[model samples]
Target: MEKLYDHLITHPLIYVARDAERALGFDLPVRGYYIITSGTSAHRKLAKQFPKNIFTVEAERNLDTHELLRHPQTKKYISDLKGAGIMVFKNTAMIEKTAKENHWKLLNPPARLVNRVEEKLEQVKWLREYADYLPPHEIAPLRNIMYEKKPFILQFNHAHSGQGTMLIKDRDTLDKLASAFPDREVRKTDYIAGPVFTSNNVILGEQALMGNLSYQITGLPPFTDLPFATIGNDFSLPHRLLTSTQLSQYKKMVTNIGHKLAGYGWKGLFGLDIAVSETTGRVHLIEINARQPASAIFESKLERDNKKRNVTGITCFEAHVAALMGIYIPNASLTPLSDGAQIVQRITKKRSAVADKVTEELGKLGLNIVTYENNAHNSELLRIQSKKYLMDDHEVLNNLGEKIKNLLD
Candidate 1:
């Protein structure tokens, strides 16, 4: 373990993001690491707690991580941390240039590969060998796609949190998009009706360290309005929801997919969204998140909490950084996280009266809350995390979820 830290500390590890609170479960030593983020309550708290380690890059809420990095203050800070290793939730060509200019290492896959695998149509071709596991999907020009008057999943080349993925139910909607982008090729598939599941997997040499499978909480009213917009993840439901055979099948699928990705010289974390057919109980690969998944920090936090009680294993975040640094944990695997859940509250109303009071009450109830200010419409404004289950078998909010939802509503 000491050797691991020794190697890791050789170059400073800097986590650059839109909000500093997102680094809650990074579990890296603060002495040799830095957090660069925009001004938020959580970011302010971290600045006070670790004055020397947190740098603020104040910007408007709509600016993303890449845009935030362009701030002169952000550049000045990076200039001081020359030769540092940069880590981010996602990678971009601009970010890669930042690293090169500062003589720092970009702790992520090359932007070219990330860009290639991110395309919805390219992912289908890349994983064609495992086509049996994918939903019936085809890529064609939007104008040429035949709509059968049924709800179908339509996807563009890139998007996040279902932003570019749409459920087209009418011919008029299809025609509108077709008229807008006639040359655009879209990935169309049968809308698989079921709860979506996602996992964060780390690719090591010849192996994929599979993390816990979580029930993807998405499109729940009061949380998000977009039908497929991701809300959060329920770590407590997967094992109970999946049969023994289904569990085995999922693991095999992910392992094989990761192995295939390894042949492409890919490393570190990549996530997969799998949808199980409600009618047939069949698992279908929905999409690939070719970079670190959004849920990694929260999930890694659970592993850290388990560590305090002597639970042993390399955590997903640990494995992620190690993989990026070209370090491998021999025979490393994580203990499956059996219980816990998290949800995000998208900003629907500006400065709602309930925001402050609810965050206070929820904190009193032992729930962890991270808030963001000035966020764009429908962007995550608050995130609630709990060690207990928040949803029931039918996917409805349990008592905990209800409590949070009621307070916010």
Candidate 2:
């Protein structure tokens, strides 16, 4: 990835930092070549990496300003960088506005397009019109009730990671659930009505670069035998879900959307969520995420092989470098890890005295344990807190708890 980035920097680069200092692990120094503007970051780390080839502007961290208005600090930074004719990466909504003010080129999804597509209702409408292959769903006001309807899913517009969602089976339960949270204004503010399913896609120019269907396997907690809901109510049995052929069909619709979005100057990574019905087998569009999905980190781990696929956390740094450089990457090949072999070996050594010896040896090489927790209970607490509020599936939480427990024990 560094090699690829080295090639891209020859054409000038823009670095938009959101918590840039922490993200890069250091401060940047200014000297020459390309223009770099700070968004959410306090300083430039690229300057540290390439001092002679980068210029920077520091942005303010004001939370009160309209996200589209450039804070005074950001405006000044943009002015300095633009005077030098350097491109800038604008991650924050305010900084994006600043870029437009100064005619600086930006690499991001267009805000209007993103705002439209990211809405749950709009996505469902768009998919129904364009794809015509989605499930039957009704988008009603949050306070509206569906008593005689079949089992259906509900979701909020701005929610992510499966928050603000529910599955309704009968009128009695739906009425009780609705009354439990009766502030119509609050419900409207928090969620929107829609179907639920997971979908992701990558596009470049007029082509679909990558697309795939994700299957979620869930289990019960240690004290229970019942499987918990993850994204939505789990169907009694697994269906074919979205097959590769269906993904191919959906690709055309996404390509069309991407093409239209490009008219607004969108050029980097984008993804969307999709839901399908079990009874009617209809597909329903959920919401679009204008930025990279959280799964992008894990997806970057997969690599193609000879007649098989593998998973490993290779090329993580490279992909980060590529995104920073604004390079279009089709695929990043990663090496697969051996099936628990290395982990087992390390565990065995840790059980013996050899673990201490290895730690001491590594310490001499400038490595040290930043932090460690040996108590299983404390470790479980940390794990639960990290995943709670973001996860609806108790099974996933339980599994994560077990993994942490195993590590501690």
Candidate 3:
């Protein structure tokens, strides 16, 4: 295959991320390019497969990209590649400083802008024009919270994968939280029970290109115990859940939000979390992820697989790099592509490992597996991907999901 990113070959390239497997989309065939990730089972596997291209950090536990960049081994690796161009899964002051010190070009939006826009409270104002789509909400400290013996959603200033989000079901739960964070301000909104959806979008100058919309599987048992922890995404299943009108509304919301981010001088990829009310069928904005999303990796690979059979589409990963490189792509080619689904098995009390026999059995079923080593509860332990849908229309796991769950169990 010819070089996927010919232009990027001009400069040394490095992708710094928490999990190396997530950066598979950026594994272009170019010299002087490297992928830096924490040493997990997946990263070790990738390093063995792409010895010269993959670099793993030495750490006792799983760490995010920012921490990995600051590791002694990571610093030594960067020191050897002085002027390389770098891309990070998320932006942070530590990452920017390391890049600047080494004279490497940073290919992401400003950390301050990214951080400011991701705040749950700030999202209310940023998405003000579409206030009708927002859930009935109020901003207040824990001391002033009034759940009224009902379920509600409370979000803190920052968190990832739903850690900073809470689903308060009763007065007792609210009281406990209030006692724990009596002074912290939070965005309290009426609980809208519903199915969640997420989409990845790219911003280039004044234009924003939307990517695929997928059914966000969260809080599923056997995979995660945390009520809001993300499990995976099902691309093919969402069409069964959303009507054409609802899909159009989703696209419009994403495009407008992307434009708003661009107005802040932000560029490249950003993701949006959305919820559709089960009672009223209303769609609401959940939150904004101001950096590369977890879905981008498999979604981009899906597009690549589709292209092999004559399908014409551009992946968010490709567009992200181009946008950061100042390349302009016509809007027609940026349409979202739907082709596959991916599920994650997070480390939890009930499940910890997939037996070797089970792994062999799963491979025979055509499920691609990527394993990770982490002892922290809810850290990703395994990832399963497929070109087929892993869910049924009823929001339950289909044959594939059940098979994987059963095997793991």
Q: Note the clash tally of each candidate.
A: 0, 7, 0
**Best by the TM-score measure:** 1
Residue 260's lDDT in candidate 3: 77
What value does the lDDT take at residue 125 in candidate 3? 68
lDDT of 1 by residue, 223-286 (tens): 7777788989999888778888778888888899898889898898899888888899988888
RMSD of each: 2.1, 10.7, 2.4
* Superior by TM-score: candidate 1 or candidate 3: 1
> Counting only residues 3 or more apart in sequence or on different chains, how many pairs clash (N, Cα, C under 3 Å) in candidate 1?
0
Tell me the tens digit of each residue's lDDT in model 2 across 1-409. 3355456445434444332221221122322233333432223444565655443444344132233224465446545554432222224456566667767666555556665666556655444445443344566665674556665556555544434445556678767766775443222111213234333344444334333344322222331112222211121111234556555555565666666555556654566555444454444444566665433333332222211453432333234334434566654433332111000111121232223444344334332122121222111111111211112232232333344334334
State the lDDT of candidate 3 residue by residue for 1-409, as single tens digits.
2233656556667888887876788544446668988887767877888887898886778778878777888878877877776788888888888767757688888888887778777767666776556789998998899968778888897867868888888888888988998999998988878899988888966778888889998888787888889889999877788988778888888878888788888888899888988988888887788998988888888877777678776778877777776777665355455557888889888777767787788788898988777677788877888888888854598888899888876
User: Could you tell me the TM-score of candidate 3?
Assistant: 0.92
Reference-based lDDT, each prediction: 0.81, 0.40, 0.80
lDDT of 1: 0.81
Clashing pairs in 2: 28-44, 134-282, 134-283, 135-282, 135-283, 156-191, 156-192
Ranked candidates (TM-score, high to low): 1, 3, 2
